[model samples]
Target chain A: MDSRVLRTRRDVLTAAMDELVEGGWDAVTHARVAGRAGYAKATLYAHWPDRLALVRDAFDQVGRMPHHEPTGDLRADLVGELVSFRTAMTEHRLDRALAVLAERAGPVPELVEVRRRFVEDGERPMRLLLAPVLSGARLEAATAMLCGAVVHATLLHGAPPTDEEVEAAVDLVLVGVTGA
Target chain B: MDSRVLRTRRDVLTAAMDELVEGGWDAVTHARVAGRAGYAKATLYAHWPDRLALVRDAFDQVGRMPHHEPTGDLRADLVGELVSFRTAMTEHRLDRALAVLAERAGPVPELVEVRRRFVEDGERPMRLLLAPVLSGARLEAATAMLCGAVVHATLLHGAPPTDEEVEAAVDLVLVGVTGA
Candidate 1:
C-alpha cells in the first residue's frame, strides 16, 4: 500500500506486458521481466509467485474499455462501436493475444473462464445498442456474427472492413436477404 | 526417390508435426525434430535448412480433407458440410493451429499464402453447395458467416453446435430473421 511499492508494482506489470507484446506469452519470464523493470528477481518473485500470476496482474493493468453511449441511429451506433473495437484490437495486437488465449482455453479452466467473462462483458454495450430492436438468442447470434466478421476481416484479410462491407454486414444481421 | 528415403522423409515430417502439436511453433527446431525421428541433425538440415521449411513440410503431411458431395437438400447439405468441417477441426486440433498461424500470418508470407490456399481450397466445396442458391459478395459473406459461427461456437464455446444450433445458424444465413 506504500506509494513507492505501488509504483514498483506498476513498473513490473508494465514490463511484463511489454515482454508479452514483444515476444508473446512464451517470452514472459520472471528474470526477463525483472530485468526490464530494473528490479531484482527476488523482488518480482516476492510480489508474484509464478509467471501466470504475473501475467494476470499485467493483463489487469490494461485500461478498461469506456462504455459507449448509443447514438439512437442504429447504423451509426453499430459502426462507431465496431470501429472502436477494431481500434482497441489494433492498439494492443489483441487478435494474437485472443488467439493464444482461445487456444489455451481448452486445457486451462482459468483461460476458459477468462474468455467467458470477456464475452459477457463485451456483449453488454452491444446489448444496450440493440435493446430496442433485438433480444434473446437472435440478439446474441447477431452480436457474434458482427464481432466475428470484423475479426476475420481484419485479422485474416489484413484490413478493417470497408464501410460498404460494414453496412452490408449490418444489413444482413438486421434482415437477411430473401430468396437466396 | 528410394522407398527407404521416402520412409525417412515421412518419419521426419511426422515427428515434426508431433512437436508442433505438443509444443507449438517454437518447438519445431531441426535438432528436436531430427532427434525425435531418430535422424542426425545433418539429415534434417540436409532436407529443410530451416525451421519454417520443416514446418511447411510437416503441415503438408496432414491428411487431405475429403471432398463432400452435396445431397441436394440445401439445409441438410449445409449442416452436413459444417458438421464435417467441425469434425476435421477436432481431429486435427485445427482451431489452435489456425490461431497460431493467423497470428504469424502478417510477417510470414509463407503463412499468408498457406492461409490463402487454405481459404481457397476449403471454400471450393462450399461453393458447390451455394452456387445454386447464391453468388458474388453475398455468397462470400454468407460463407464467412457460416464459417465464423461454426468456429466461434466450436472453439470458443468448447463444443460443436447441437443439431438445433447448426440448423438455426443455417436458417439465419439463408433467410435471416425479420424485424431484427
Candidate 2:
C-alpha cells in the first residue's frame, strides 16, 4: 500500500474502526481518521459524510463474539455466554461503542439498526444455548435479566461486571427459569 | 421573570434542563441555551466552560423520583418501584440526559457521580423494600438484575419497558428470591 492515495473504501472504514478501538467514538473524527487512512478529508466525507456515519460503518464489523461451547450444563452454558458478553464488552471497547447509541435523545434509525444487529448477533449464541431448556417469554426474560445485569452493572460501576458478578447474575436467572 | 435579565441562577439551570428535556443533550448547544436563558454565550460559557459543564450542573438537580407507597407485599412493592422507574425514565427525559454520559469513551467522573446519585436515589425504595427479605450477595445480585433489566430493555427497544413488562420482570426476580 502506497503512503499517498493508495487504498479502497474498506481501508478507510478499517481505519475508522482502528481509531474507535484505540480511543473510542470520539477518536473517529474527520481529521484523525482521514490522516490515518491516507485519504483526504473530502474523500472520507464523500463516503461516510459524518462521524456517526463512519462509526456506523465501524460497527458493522462488531458483535461477532467468540463461540462459547456448551458443556450440556444449562447453568454453566448460561454463565459462559454472559461471561463472554462481559469479556466482549470490556475487551472490544463495546461499552463505548454502545455509548454511541446509548446517548441519543431520539435514536437515529440507521444507528439503531446497527445496535439491533449487534444485539441480535450477541444474543444468538445465548439463544442457541438456552433454547432446549428455556423457551418463549421465560427465555426472553432470562436473556434480558442476564444481559441487563451486565449493562446495568457497567452503568453503575463504570466497568464491566466481574466474573463472580456474572456468575451470581446468571444464578439469579437460573432459579427463575428452572424452579418448580 | 423579566424578558431581559430578571432571574436567578435557578432559572438558568432550569433552562438548561428544559433544553435537555425537550431536545436532549445535543440541543443544549451554546447558541440555543444562551438564547433561551436570556444570557449571552459568554455568560453561559463563563459559568459552564463547555457543554459538559453545563450538563453537569443540570444533572445536579435530577433524580428525585416520586414516592411509591409500599404495600406489605414484597412482590407488589418491587414491581411498584420498577414501574415507577420506567415511568421516570420516560417522563423526566432521563434517557437523553443519561446518553450525555453514556456516549463518552470513558465515564466522566463528575457525571458518573450524578448517575451514581440517580441510581442510589432510584434504588433506595428497592433497598428498603428488599432489606427485610434479602441481604448480602443475594440482595446485590437482585438489585443489579432488576435495574439492569430496565436499562437493557430501554437500550434494546429504544423506549422504557411498559408497566406490564416491568411486572413480568419483577416476577422473574421474585422466583429467584422465593424458591421451591
Candidate 3:
C-alpha cells in the first residue's frame, strides 16, 4: 500500500473513533467518518470497504501502540504495564471505542475475531513479563487478573491510574505470585 | 407494599433486565418492559413515574443482594466477594443499564447520590473483610483493584467467574497484600 494511502486510512480510522466516543457507536457511519476526516465517502470505501473492517483496522492500530518493556524484574514490569494500561485508557479513545464495539458486536463472527485479536495483542506483553514470575496455571490466572483490573479501572472509572495506585496494585499481585 | 405487588414489581424489573441484555439499554423502554412483564404501561407508570426511577430501583434491588459473610479468613472472604461480583455481572442486567443511565445522568446530583450509595454499599463488606489483611491506603488500593478486576472480567469478557477463578484471583490479591 502507498504510504499516503496508509496515512489516509489512519486519519479516517482516527476520525471514526472520535465520532464513536462523541456519539456512541451508532454515529460511526461511513459517511459521517468520511465527513469528519474531510475525505469523500468513495475514498473511505476504497480503503476499508466495510465499516467493521474500518473498526477492526483502527483497533488493530491501537493494539500495536508501543508498550513498556519488561525489565526482567516482575514487580517493575507489572508497574510499568499498569502505567501503560492506565495511559492508554485515559489518553486514547480506542478503549472507549472498543467497549462500544464489544457491546454491539453481539455474535458477529468478524467482530468477534477482531475483538479476540485486539485482546490477545494487548495482553501479549503483559503475559511475557509475567511468565518468568509465575508457573503454569498461576501465570495464566495472574495475567487475566492484571488485564481485567487495568481495563476495569480505565473504562468504568473514566480515570487513568496514578503511579502510586499502579505501584500498589502491582505489589499486591506480585505478593500473590511470589508469596513474598 | 402488598406481597403480590412486590412480586409484580420484581417481575417487571426482571423483564426489563432481560430486554436490556438481549438488545442493549435502548431496548428497555417502559412499554416494552411492561409488555414483557404482561403488565400495561399504566401499571408500570403506577410503580415508577419515569424510566430513570425504574432503572434506579431495579439497580438498587440488584445491588442489595446479600454479600458473602466475612469468614475471618481473608482469602476466603475475598474469594466469595469476587464470585458474587462475577455473578452480578453475568446474571443481572444492572451493570449495562447503569452504564446507559450514567451517561444520561452525567454529573446530575441525583445520579451522583445514587452512584455514591451504590459504591458505598458494595464497598462495605469488602472493607470489613480486607481490613484484617490490609490497612491504610493499601486496603483501599487492594479493594479498588479487586473491584476493578471483577467488573472488567464481567463487563468486558462476559464471563462470570467460577469458584476456581474467583479463588485464584483473590489469592493473588490477598497474597500480594499480605506478603507485601
Between candidates 2 and 3, the one scoring higher on lDDT is 2
Report model 2's TM-score to 2 decimal places. Answer: 0.85
Cα lDDT for residue B52, candidate 3: 63
lDDT of 1 by residue, A105-155 (tens): 644457676665565565567667766765555555566666666666655
List where candidate 2 sits over 4 angstroms from the true fold. A1-11, A18-27, A40-53, A105-107, B1-7, B21-31, B39-53, B105-107
lDDT of each candidate versus the true structure: 0.69, 0.71, 0.69
lDDT tens string, model 1, B1-180? 999999999999999877776666778898899899999999889999998888787667764665556888887888788777777667767665655566556445577766666656665676678777765665656666666666665555566556565665666666742333
Worst-scoring 10-residue span by lDDT in model 3 chain A: A152-161
> Each candidate: how many clashes?
0, 1, 1
TM-score of each: 0.83, 0.85, 0.84
Better of 1 and 2 by DockQ: 2
lDDT of the structure predicted as candidate 3: 0.69
- Is model 3 an incorrect, acceptable, medium or high docking prediction? acceptable
How do the residues B55-142 of candidate 2 rate in per-residue lDDT, one tens digit apiece? Answer: 7777666646675789898888888788777777777666666655555426445567766666677678887887786777677767
lDDT, residue A134, model 3 = 78
Ranking by TM-score: 2, 3, 1
Candidate 2 chain B lDDT trough over 10 residues, lowest sum:
B1-10
